[model samples]
Target: MAEDMSNEHSQDDSGLHAWMLAWYDHAVSVGFIRPPFLLNDVTAERLEGYFRVGLTPVEGAEAFFGVAH
Candidate 1:
């Protein structure tokens, strides 16, 4: 299950920064996948999976996934 990071930035805790950073990093990484259709029924779960996998190093993939593009 996905962790709720809605208030992650509100906390003054040091760990929150890492959490939020990871989230934004993941979001940017997956945003460049180029889905089949814009109006398609895309869900967060599917996107989350892409983001998770995108975080890893894969053959033929960019050095920084899609985040740097």
Candidate 2:
């Protein structure tokens, strides 16, 4: 029924960000998807995003996922 919206293409522009923020708010209000939540905290909803998007093993496992700090 609600096939009007298209989240396929990413609008990385600043203007798009603002527009999407408003759109997300409205969509949540109308029950399209649940509200956004943090990944660290085990809350209502958390987007895994990409399952296999982490470090490669053996070759340079230590360098992978390394922080600047």
Candidate of highest TM-score: 2
lDDT of 2: 0.34
Q: Which pairs of residues collide in candidate 2?
A: none
Candidate 2 residue lDDT tens string, 1-69:
233333333432443445435544554565555756222433111111111232122212223223547
Residue range with the least summed lDDT across 10 consecutive positions in model 1: 55-64
Q: How does candidate 2 fare on TM-score?
A: 0.33
Whole-model Cα lDDT per candidate?
A: 0.41, 0.34
List where candidate 2 sits over 4 angstroms from the true fold.
Answer: 1-12, 37-69
Pairs in clash, predicted candidate 1 = none
TM-scores, all models, native as reference: 0.29, 0.33
- For candidate 1, the C-alpha RMSD (Å) to the true structure equals 10.1
Which residues of candidate 1, in runs, are more than 4 Å off? 1-12, 32-69
Best prediction by lDDT:
1
